[model samples]
Structure formats: structure tokens, C-alpha cells
Target chain A: MSLRIPSVLVSLVALGALAATPLAAEPKSRFKVGWSIYVGWMPWGYAADTGIVDRWAEKYGIAIEVTQFNDYIESINQYTAGAYDAVTLTNMDGLSIPAAGGVDTTAVIVGDFSAGNDAVILKDSTSLAEIAGRNVNLVEFSVSHYLLARALDSVGLSERDVRVINTADPDMAAAFQTRDVTAMVTWNPIVSEIAAMPGANLVFDSSDIPGEIIDLMVANTAVLADNPDFGKALAGIWYETAALMVADTPEGAAARAAMGAASGTDQAGYEAQLAATRLFADPAEAVAFTLSPDLGTTMDHIRTFLFDKGLLGAGAPSADVIGIELPGGAVMGDPANVKFRFDATYMQLAADGAL
Target chain B: MRLINRHPGRAARLFLGSLPFLILVVAYLVASAARLADNPGDKLLPALSSFAQAIETMALTPDRRTGAYLLWSDTWASLTRLWAGLGIATAITLVMGLAIGVLPVMRALLAPVVAFASMVPPLALLPILFIALGLGETSKIALIVIGVTPFLIRDLSLAAAALPREMIVKAETLSASTWLIALRVVLPQVMPRLLDSLRLQLGPAFLFLIAAEAISADSGLGYRIFLVRRYLSMDIIFPYVAWITLLAVAMDLGLGGLRRLMFPWWGLEGRR
Candidate 1:
């Protein structure tokens, strides 16, 4: 008996067509927010765990789910794939992963930046200039690589002067103890651990280059545009928890300790990580930072590094490929094809007690 | 005859072997084309032309950063680790397998321990290895060795122990010492089995090598795939995966050819 191949092909084509057909316009009922472990982004987990997220979401008449991902990159990828309405990621990654992948994304919350959180450590050395002629172990192509590039440039050196061994983040701590590992670049907790070891010294860190490695909660641009309540709900949840986490009170300490324990650290350890991070807990400050000219220059440097590394879309001709829209309608890159935007509207609302 | 056991002639064998792979490639091309037609900038499934362009840049072009071709360097780094791991594991297993196979005392001491160790997942021990071995090449090579050595020892020892008792007795009757029996009689008989065990292990060895490299290496096939994975550069990733698979197949073929050439009497019944 011969199977009807033409009929089968027609059925497959029909299924594809059905998938392509858009649904009738309706108000979205549910939203998902993706987050991973980071000192600044920990408030997302805390809000979700303590029903703070649920309260805000109910007020906005929407169901919001907060999901935690183990791998940081995977969470961004999922967000780019439209699996989540919002995802907590760094600014460069928000640009590189989703915006670069052709997904329209907007930073709803400018949470924080690494102050002294990420660092370069050298064995028996006290200066960044001594890092030359050494093998630096770090996760290649990560924010650490960006930090290393900036570190090297400051010392009037380049990557050619040293070797970059692409060690995994998990291995960075252990790799530092080995005799061959004279120099390395990595972020908090590991930096804390390795710096305590004998003969290890912090040469340079993110504190020198503030506002560059920014953490953000970016949402799908279309989702925020259609459901402004989602934006309001997200901002309210963040600032409420941020207030609790930052207050010098017993309740605040309990809130912070819970966040710390959730992220595999204690209250003191988490507070140390928080110290290294410049968390914009005050709504007005975060909005001010978003509107600052420093944000513009920071993005300019990041785009240059990303474009040079081919992190921007492959077809990109120059650093001006993806247009990043800042506050006050000022545009960066090809303005006609803008995909990434920094909107502090909801943050302003939170600051004015209007949410 | 059952359809499963039906024999195919040479021409038929070639066509039959390639049919499934051909179908898979065609399906992928169609799916990729459909996705691209919808969104030309899709990185999840890049077009065929983009793959060609990616390979040209990776293989033919010298990298602007370090002035080295990435593909060749990655292959060299990964293969060097693989060979070192496989070589050390083979040497250690040969010595230990012979001991455990011939002497009950050695068997009682090691066999149970090895069998238990193999049950423990090698991936779980990865963090400990990095900590104890200090995240250099020593740890990577050690992972590959630890992952494969237990099985190799078990297989080779079984082959040695199953040898006919008459062979050892005849050698003993000729006033041969225990060392002489082990060297002349047992060693020669077990050589072909060692080749067979090594051939079967090529896949798992590559797996462990890639895992180790992914965790900690500056240059390797796995490292390149994973590093670019952060940017969702599937164009580079697809080609690298195919290249690694080709290298593995070549190594498997080379091992089979060596076995046939070195021991003419081995697997003489068929090339199965």
C-alpha cells in the first residue's frame, strides 16, 4: 500500500500556516519574569518568594510568574525566544542576546552596576601593569573579558601582551591557586574567595569603570507597550523589595538574609556582595542614572567592544548597527531600526508615589 | 529471513548507509529555509550560505586578535588532550588488567573497588577534580582517564581471565616461570582484545575530553562552540560540531584499520 506523500506534505504546510496566523487581539492575562543569581537581581527572587510579586501583579489584574534559571546566558536566550515577558540581565547582554537576535527589548528597571564586584587578581603582584606576559584565566567572551579589555587599555597594554585562557566561571577560583595561574579576571564571591588566598592581590576592578557593567530587568517591548500595568507592576515590586532590602532595620536585615540564603550566601556575605554592587535602590536615583550622560558614554564603549567581537548581528557593518534609544529621545546607532530602549517611565512613577 | 538480518551487497550497502543521513540533511535544510524565509536574521537556524561564510572565516582566515586560525588550533588542542588521556589510560589498564586477570589476590583487592568507582558519575566528580588537580591540563586529562579507565580494565581483564586453562598448564609443564607464562602466553593472547576495547572506547573518550575542555580550556573545539554559544552564533557552532564528528569517525576508522593490519588472525571471521 503506497502512502499518499502529497497529502502528507499538504497537511504539513497547512499546519505551518495555522501557526503563522496571528490570534485575534485580546488583553494578555499572564506574564513571566526570568531571573538568575546576582547581587543586584536577588530582589526578584525575594519578591517572588515573599508574595510581593503576587500582590503587585494582582493589583494590576495580571498573573505574573518569576522563574529562576541556573545558567545566566540561557535565561537571556529564553527571553529572546519570547518565553518570558521580562528577564534580568546585564545591559551588554540585554543588547547582545535579545536585541542582537532581532527581539525588541526595553530596560524597564536599571537595577545596579558592578562597583568593585568584578576584579582582576594577580599572584604576588600589586599593579595591573604587571599582568603582562601572564596567562589570565577567565570565562571568555563574558563581562569579565570586557573588564579585562578595559583593564589592559588603562595600563597602555593590549590582549597581545598577555594570554587569555578561557576557564569556566566555576573553575576560576581553583585555577587561581595553581602555580601556572599568575593572573585572572572574575566577579564577586570568587574574587572574595581568591583574594583571601595567600599571595593573591586585587590589581583592578569594576569600581574604576563604574556604570559600565549595568544590571537590568528588560521586558519585551511589545508586551510593555500593550500592558503598561505590567511595567507598573514590575517597578512597584522592585522598589518595594529594594526599600526593604536597603533599610537599616531588623525587618530589612531579615529580608536581606533571606535573599542571601536563597542565593547560596549568608547575610554578611550577601551584604559584602551588595557593597561591591552599586544597587540603585532608590527609585529617583535609578531614574536619574538612566537619564545621565554617563549612561550614554558607557553604552558607547560597550557597543564598540561588542561590535569588535562580532557580538552584534553578523551582518552588522559597524558599531552603529543596533540603535539604542536613551531618555529625552536621543538615539544611538541606526535610529530607524532601533531595538533597545531605556525607558524610566514606571521608575518615575514609583519615585512620585503614583504607582 | 527477518528484515533486520537481510544482507545488502556493496552498492546497496553504500546507498543504505547514506539514506538516513541524506534524509536528515534534507529535512534540516527545509526547516532552516522555512525559518529564514520568515526571519532572515534568525540565528537559531542559519542559512547554508552563512555556514559556508562562517567556515571560510574560521578555517581559512587568520584571526585578527591573535593571528591564528581558530579551527586548526582548536582541533590541535583538543586532539592533544584526547591522545594523552587515551594513551595513559591504555598503559595503566594493560598493566592492571593483566594482574587482576591472572591473580585472585589482585582481583579481590581491585575489581570490587573499580566496579564501585565506575558507578559514581564522572561528571559529579568534575568540581572535586578541578579543586584537587588545580584546573590545569592535569585535571582535564585526569577526567578523561578516570571516566574511561575503569571500563577498559574490566573488559580487558575479562578477556584475559576467559583464556583456556590448557594454554597456561602447557606453558607451566615446559618449566616456564609465572612471569614467562604471563609474558609469552597471556600477553600475546590479550593483545587483540586490548585493541577491541580501545576501539569501543573512542566515543566516550571524546565525550570526556570535550566536557573537560568546555569546563577549562582556552582553545578547543568544545571551548569555541561554548564561547560563541553565548552570542547565539549557531552558524559557527554547527560547522564546528560537524568537524568534531568527522574527526571522531576518522579516528574510529584508523583504529579498525590498525587492528586488521597488526593482527591478521584477529576478527578473521568477519569485519563485524
Candidate 2:
């Protein structure tokens, strides 16, 4: 009763091979964009659920797929890996990961920046300098880590002065409850939760760095170049949604409430997160911010931090490994290897009623 | 030649055993090729060359920032925690399991409590452990011990209780003291079963270890996997997962070999 299993396996393999042949073709009209849970990027989910994304994409005769990722790093990773055409990421991550990974990316939309959203709290102390010689828990290599470095710099100290324990974001809130974790750097919701605990004091926040920690909607440079309509539609969708979210009307409040619910928080919690987030409500203002001289200065700090942290890729002789092209014909780092292009043309068009 | 002739279908049996693995590899390759053909930058089903490159970077090369080989260091850190947790659990289970299995009074007092405690998911107790034990090696190690100890106790107790009543009667007939009988008669029989129970608990132990490390730790196989997951670096992740599988397989094989070598009679009966 010996069965000839090999023949059956071979036929199955042949069938799979035949099925795989047509999957190599690309989908020209479809584009995927990934977003993670955050105060600024919550509008993306709202736009997708409310049919706003489809409406804008329909105007351009294209389809947009909005994907949400629970993990913040995964969104940027998918974008870098070409699984998504665009992603929502912070300015520092945009410079460190995708651009450093040799993916040409464009900052199409400056969504918002964390003002007081990301913060550092102490168990009993009231000052940043008091953080020295204490175990500071944070998600290492995240925006919170960058924020901690800047906080330490402000106090005439360095990372060497304190020991950082790499605690996951979900655990940071409860980890702070422990007596050993005297200090912690984390983002909103968790930061708010920990701050409410007895004896916890907010000592530092992203407000000190102002617009340094910029949140953005960045697209693959090659994809945007091939289909400029995608960028135009995305920018239109973002500005429209941003306008709706900030408006004092009932429609706007309802929109914000939907975004809040999508982000796993209630309206009040979402509103608190939004209050700490400085939204660039106006496209003109966003364009101005992109073209401002402050961007270059902020990028310089970001590039320096990323390079120092060895996030600029191995064998990076200097911070000049990945070049960034600003809006005003300015290039930071090596122009020969420019990967991050800050093009404000789409935002400008949106502002001038041309899009 | 005699052994080969005796087992005429040995080669065929070996090939049949490996067919499933061969099919899995082929399927993965076909799927990966299709993805790479569509998008060469696909990280989920990365090409084998990319895995080689990733391995060279993470395993061979020293990290520019930390100045350590990440794979080896992570393995060492995880192995240390795992061994420490298992070692403590084994000691506690051996002592308590023997008493509860042989002494009816001890079993009545502790068996139900152990059963109830095991029902509560260990992950739920992670925060409590961190708060009580602090965010150090102690909490992580305690998580593994707490997760696997109850199952080990239960299994060892059952094995001990299932031992022949005639052996105990004979020992008592020979005027054997309780301590001497427990040690000379029971411990020898229980040692092999303890190893068997430990082998069964390894999967759960690894689960508890990874959960703890993923929640909080600077370095561990689990920590590294979760960390690199953010980058969607599947190349690195694939190799790390393969390495963990290899380590677990080796540990299981080693325990099986030890069981055979130390308790041939018990091993023979178990095989039967």
C-alpha cells in the first residue's frame, strides 16, 4: 500500500508556479499609505473611514489604501520596504531610517509637531538636572529618546550622566509606578497617565525643541515623481481633513470625535492629545514653515543626533552620508547623495487654490 | 552492512521524514520569488542573499554604537535568564513535588492551590512582579519560574504517585526509614520523569522569557526580535528566529540523550 506522494507534491508545486506568474505585475491606479497611532496621524483613519480619502482619490482617478499599524516603527518600516507608497513619520525617523536605508523620500505634507505631547517625568524631582544618576526608562531609539538627549543637553549634562533602561511604551506607564524607575521619558496618553500618579512631576517636554520633532506625511520619491496626482490628492485630503478637525462647528467636533475613537481614546483624551500637538492648520503656514531658515537649523540638530546615535548607517564617515534638499534650494549634507527632498510645491498649490 | 541490511527501508524512511521540510522550503522560495519579482524591495519575503547580508551585519559585525555582536550577546543574555529561571524552578519543584506526591497531607494542602495559581495567566502577573520584584533580572527570571513551576510540580507528583505501591510496601517490610525510602527508592525513579517534565515545559518557559524580555530588557533574543520588528527587517528577524529554534532543538536533544544515558531502564519502558 505504498502511496506515490511525490507525484502529487510535484503537481501541486507546478500549480503554484503557474499561479505565481501573473502576480509580478504592478497596480498603477492603487497606492498604499501606512499610518500608526498618534495624535497627529489620527486624521488619516478619519479621512479613510469618512470617505474623504476616496472622494479625493476619485477626483484624481486613483485609489488610495490607508493602512493602520499598531506599532509606530512598523509603519515607517513598511514604507521603507516598499510595501506602502507613503507613511506618517517624525522628521528624525524620516532622516534616520528610510533615507538612511537608501530610499528616496519626499516630505509631501507637514502634518503637525509635538509641542507638549512628548514629555519626561520624575517621581519626586521638579527639574531636568535632577535626572542625573537615575535610571530613566524610555523606548530607546524612539522620538522620546531623542527628546531625552535634548533635555539632557539643556541642563549642561549628557546621556552618560544617566542610565537609560529600555522599557516598552505600554510598560512605561506602569514601570514608572515602581520606586526604582525614578525618571521616564514617554509620549502622550502614557505621559498623561503617568503624570497623574502621585509624586510624579512633569520636568521636560518637546515644547523646548519647538518644531524640531516634526510629524510629516512622506511619500516614496520615485512613486511621487511617477504619479504627481497621488501627492496632490494626498495633500488635498490632509488639508481638508485638518481644516475640518480644527473648525469650531458641530461638523468639526464630530470629525474630531471620530478621530479620537479611531485612535483608541475618547473625545476628551483625543482633544487633550490634540491640544499638546501643534497642528499646521493652514497650508500656507505649513509652506512657510518648510521654507523657513529654522528648518535647516532643526535638521542640522536632527542629523547630528542621528549620526551620533549610529542610526545613519554603518560606515557613515560623517552626518553627510544622507543629503536632505530643503524647499528653498538649500541642500544639507552631501548633495550627491540626496535622499530626502522637502518639496513645498503641492502645499503651495493647495494654498493658492490651484490644486 | 549488517545494520543497513536489517533496516532495508531506512533510506526511504529518512527521505519521507524530510519531505515536509523540503516542501516548506520550496513553497517559501516560490512565494518569495513572486514577491521579489513584483517589488524587489519587499522585506517580508526577502531574498536569501539579503538574509546572508543581514546575518553578516547582526551576527558577524560589531554594532557601531554598542560595539558588540548583537546576535551572540542577545543569545547569551536570553540563555542566562532562561537557565536561571529553570534552575530555580527545578529545585523548588523537586522538593515540593516529592513531599506532595508521597505525603497525603502535603498534597491536600498545596495541590488545589497550585492548580488555581496555574489557571491565572502569568502575563497578567507581569506588572505585579515588576512592581514587587523591581524592573531587574529578578522579575524577568521570576516570570519564567512562576509560569512553568506549577506544571512541572503537577507532572512530577503524578509520576511519583503512579509508582508501584508494592515497592513502598517492600521498603517498609525491610524496616526502611521514611527519609531513606524516599531518597533511595523514590528519587531515582523521579529523576528521569523530572527531566521529561522539564522538556515539556521548555516551550512555555521560552514564552514567558520572551514576554518578559519584550516588555523590558536592553538585550535578549526576544528583545532584539521586537526591536528589529520596528524596522521591518525580516532578514535579521528570520535568522534570529531560526537560531532560537536551533537552540531549543539542541536543548531538547541533549535532555533526551541524558535521559537515555542516565536511566536506560526507564527510557526503555518509556519508549515501549
Candidate 3:
């Protein structure tokens, strides 16, 4: 109901913008990066609050605007619509949403992957096999759903065996309290909250199928190509904040506490979440992971999954419709129509202490 | 001449009524075409061809996994929940509204509670509904009932209470008891008003139903919109919204027909 006011205001602003466009047209030096609440991506918010983002931007003679979103998917959608120059999302989402939607996106940083943070929790179910016939509840088409698909595949069962109930994240916890909802697949801190329920069994998690659900900071390829300094500024801001988040110093402790508070938790709660995530706190490790051969295999799996779910753009006959240019000039999908790329230059620069 | 006296002919009135809609459609098309020309993949405003393809895909083609044409199944699911919720609310309101208005004791007890409950935002209890009633159709229906029942009761009760006191006195003089006066005098006046209250409450009921479904549901028009929204599929979302509007308009028309058939004398400007 409140949206109507903003919609009317937006139209007025749009009309005003039309009149002001001529005077405002200039070379773009400022970039906006959209991020949502996540353990791996929390550093973006912390850095922005502490002026690390602006400091790096000043160093590179550019201005970077880091904004936080309450919704994960909304940030990605806005980024895909050209409202933001960059966004933080999982590799699967990057491929399925922006890449499939014809936005040329490139990963500037590989943050972390879920180890045990995401899970499939079943009430009174002891093993993954018990989940065969039950309807799996999750945020449909999200990483949780992808995890469920992978979980079912491990046991030789396909999506045909069980129905997928598309439940929202806010309702998943309460829905699980009802006896009718016996099984759910979700991510932490939701996963951690659900696991504490009586008779709840954590049958499978991202830890079991590691490195597939990668967290990344992806930017528009055309925008990055025009302004290399924007990429450098982002890499600089990230490494500095990443170092502080995991350090044993008091300042690091304070950084973690602020991030936890910003993410709707406390210090200990944030630490518990960090324990389940495989955070690449080191720049070199992040670069190594981005260039690894396993990334190719993971991308192959992701593209195939997206194609099967019909998320790889409309009328896409195969997974090859959206090309993904990997590191070292190797391309997956159609080489002629590359839209998603895994670029490692900025991260490599960060690793070599050259950023 | 006064502005109220300057009325158009029926043909002119129809054209005037339709002018705004035509202008909106033309504006949307022009904006969409311009966006598409700049970047064909703009999902914010989908092209006309994209809309046609989306409509065909959702309304005509059967889903791959479920083998159900999404449009019909969603409509069936949503309509069933709406009917069940509104029907149960209307029945409860008729009985309670009459009791509260005709009987002093019932009014003293329920009027305060009804006012309080009506003020409580219905969406706030959505999670509790899921927790208490489970995630099935029951919780979704319960949300709608909890959302609109109080208002329906209030409307009917006021209509019942407004009956001239002399009628009740005369009925009592003829040996009509409390129950007799409620049945003979109050129910007759309030029954038609119940229909009006139900008609007014349809829009709000649909809002509650869609919110519940969007949060959690296996199938519904709201569920489909939120589900495909993960991929930013505006192509599908726009059409599903239009279909829901059309369905709501048809329902309004149906209720208006029922009102005319059942009680042709009852109307907004007092009974004929």
C-alpha cells in the first residue's frame, strides 16, 4: 500500500529527469554496487559504514556508492535492470538472472562458498532417502532449491519424485512448526534456527556438495571495461575489509560486531555463521579459486541446471544460448554471445599487492 | 449552469469512461516500445510481442511438470479460497450481527471486541496463522476470515441497530419475544445489508488471500507471480495481474446480479 506514494513520486522524478538529462550528461566516474545481507557479503556494508569504500574510491580517483538492500533477489533484479553497476549474488543466480536476462556481467571478486550454512532439514527424517516422496519446501528457483535438486540427484532421485513448494524465507520457519510441513531446504541463519527444532534432522548441506554454490561480487562487463579504476577501488575496499573481519585484533572484533548488528544479529551469532562459511579472507586464495578448473565444472553444472529449469532466457534451446567467458579466455556456451564472464584481473592485482 | 446538470448522452458517457483506460494503454505501449528499441531485453517494460508470448505460454500451454494449464488452475485455486473465506465470514456475520444489534447483552459484550479486532492489522497475524493452522488451505482461508469478518459484522450490526425502536416495541406488544423480534424484524432488514457488506469487502479479502499465497502456497495466481519473479519475468507477471483484475470484475458483476435477483428492492439510496 505504501508503494503507491513512491510510484507516483518516481514518475514525477522521471519527468523531472527528462528535463534535466541534457545538463547532467557527463563522463561517468561514480558507480553503485548493490548488496544484501549475507555472512560473506557483510563486509560490503561494514566497509561502507566505516568509509573504507569511499577511501578506496578516492584513492583510485573515482567515487563508488555501496548500497545495502533488504532483499537478495531485488538487488540482483535492480542490477540486471541497469540500476546498479554491480551486485553480490551466488554463481547460480548470476548465471540464471542477469546472464540469462542479457546483462553482460563479470565477477570481480570470489568471496566465499557455503560449507554447512545451507541445509535440508526434515522433521522426523533421519536420512536424505526419507525425503523422496515428501514435498520439498523452499524459496523456489533460489540456491536452496538448487541445493535440493543436487541433494535429490545424489540419491538417484530426480525432481519428478517430489513436488517443490515455493515458500518465502520469512514464512519458512513458522511453516515448519506446522505438522503439515515436514521437510524444508533453506540457508543460515534460517538453517541454524530450524535445526534447533525438535525432531529436525539436517540430512544434507552445502558442505557435502562443496564449491558449487559460490558467492561472488559481479559487475557489468561494459562498465568495468570503460573504467578499470572502479574495479581496482572495489578490490582494494574488499581486501582491506576482509582482513579486518577475520583478524584477531580488537578492531576486527568491532568490525564483526557491527556487521552482525547490521545483519540483524550479534557478534557471537555472526561468528557462528562464519564458521559454516568457507570465506576466502586472503586475496590470493580468492584469485586461485576463480581460476581453478573446478569452477568450469561448476559452471557447466549450473548452466545445465538453469537450462533444465527454463531459467536460461526465453526460447533458449540449450544451455549454450548464454555464453560465459571464463578466466584465460576459455569460454563456455556460445562464444559469439558471451554475457557472463569470470574475470580475475582485479583479484590477481589484489593478490600481487598491486591494487 | 451547474456542473452536475451538464450530463453527456449514453454514447458520450461510454466514450468518456473509456478515455482514461485508452490513454493508459497507449502510454504503456509507447514507453515499452521505446525501452525495447534501446535494449530489447529490458524486463522492466516488456514488449507487446513478449506479452503475447507470455500470455500464450501461461494461459494456453500446459506446464511441463504439473500438466496443468497455469492460468485456469491458479484461478480455480484462488477463487476457491476466496469463496470459502467470504462465505464463512458472511454466515458468521449474519448470525452475530443480528444478535449483537437486537440483543442488548450481546452488543455490550461483542461490540468492543469487534472494534478492537477490526483495528488489528490482519497481515501481522499471517505468520501466527501459519504456525497455528499449518501451511495448508486452512491457514490461507483463516487469514481472509480474520481480516474481513469484523468489518462485515460491524456493518450489518449498525444496519440492524438503526431499525426504529417503535417496531421492536410493537412486536413485543404482540407477544414477540427477543428471538421473535430478531428473526422477524432485524433479520429482514439486515440480510440485504449483509450482501452489501460482502460486496464491499471483496477487494480487501482478495488482498489478504494473495498476500498469504505469495508468502507460501503450492498454487495460486499470487504464487505464480512471486515464483516467476525470481527471474524478473515481468512478461508473465503483467498478464497474471490483468487476469486477476478481470476475475475480480466478473465476481463483482456476479454479486450485483445476485443482489438484483434476490432483493430487487434494496439499494444504496434506500429501498424502493
What local distance difference test score does each model get?
0.85, 0.85, 0.86
Candidate 3 lDDT tens digits, A153-234: 9999998988888899977778788888889999988887888889899999999989999999999888888888888888
Can you tell me the CAPRI class of model 1? acceptable
Best-to-worst ranking by TM-score: 3, 1, 2
Residue pairs in collision within model 3: none
Indicate the worst ten consecutive residues by lDDT in candidate 1 chain A: A1-10
Q: Which is the leading candidate under DockQ?
A: 3
DockQ ranking from best candidate downward: 3, 2, 1
Off by over 4 Å in 1: A1-27, B1-19, B268-272
Docking class of 2: acceptable
Clash-forming residue pairs, model 1: none
Q: Write the per-residue lDDT of candidate 1 for residues A229-331, one digit (tens) a residue.
A: 9999999999999999999999999998998898788999999999999998899999999999999999999999999888896668999998999988799
Off by over 4 Å in 3: A1-27, B1-4, B173-175, B268-272
Model 2, A128-199: lDDT tens per residue? 899999988988778888999999999999998998878888778778887788999999889888888999
Residue A134, model 2: lDDT of: 91
